[model samples]
Target: MTLTLEERVRLFGSPIPEGFTVRVVESGTVINDEIVSDTKVVANGYDLYMTDKVFETMRDKCLSKTSKVWGEAKS
Candidate 1:
């Protein structure tokens, strides 16, 4: 099922998955390209955005750092 940004956000806090750190860069604009005048602006009409580089880095870290020891122990 396709999950909307709000639904996903409800299911998972931020765009960054659990157990990982995310570095968000404020481009001073919303994901829809609207200029943000205030830092207090919540993600009302916008989705939390991140650069491709950040996404890739998080993905790589999660994949590489997953423990294989749990599987070994189970077996």
Candidate 2:
């Protein structure tokens, strides 16, 4: 089964705060070359009405960028 953004965030030891919402900007891949476990998510509100500055501020405080590039980076 596919995991939600909250579950994936918990995998990294950072859970988003209450009243904050996020959506997947780019779905993660499970391929050989790029094994991105966590998707690219943005701090958009529940109805996608959050402003950029507020979203960015919350994202910076709550989330982190996840990447798992193989070969040179994944060694």
TM-score list, all predictions: 0.32, 0.25
What is the TM-score of candidate 2?
0.25
What ranges in model 2 sit over 4 Å off? 1-46, 64-75
Model 2 agreement with the true structure over 1-75: per-residue lDDT tens digits = 664545555574344545554433333433334433243233323422333444565465444333221112321
> Which candidate number maximizes lDDT?
1
The C-alpha RMSD in Å for every predicted model, in order, reads 10.4, 15.3
Clashing pairs in 1: none
Tens digits of per-residue lDDT for model 1 on 1-75?
Answer: 875544444566343446554335454645455544334322433344454455565455443333231232211
Predicted structure with the largest TM-score when compared to the true one: 1
Give the poorly placed runs of model 1, Cα more than 4 Å off: 1-46, 67-75
What is the Cα-based lDDT of residue 19 in candidate 1?
Answer: 55
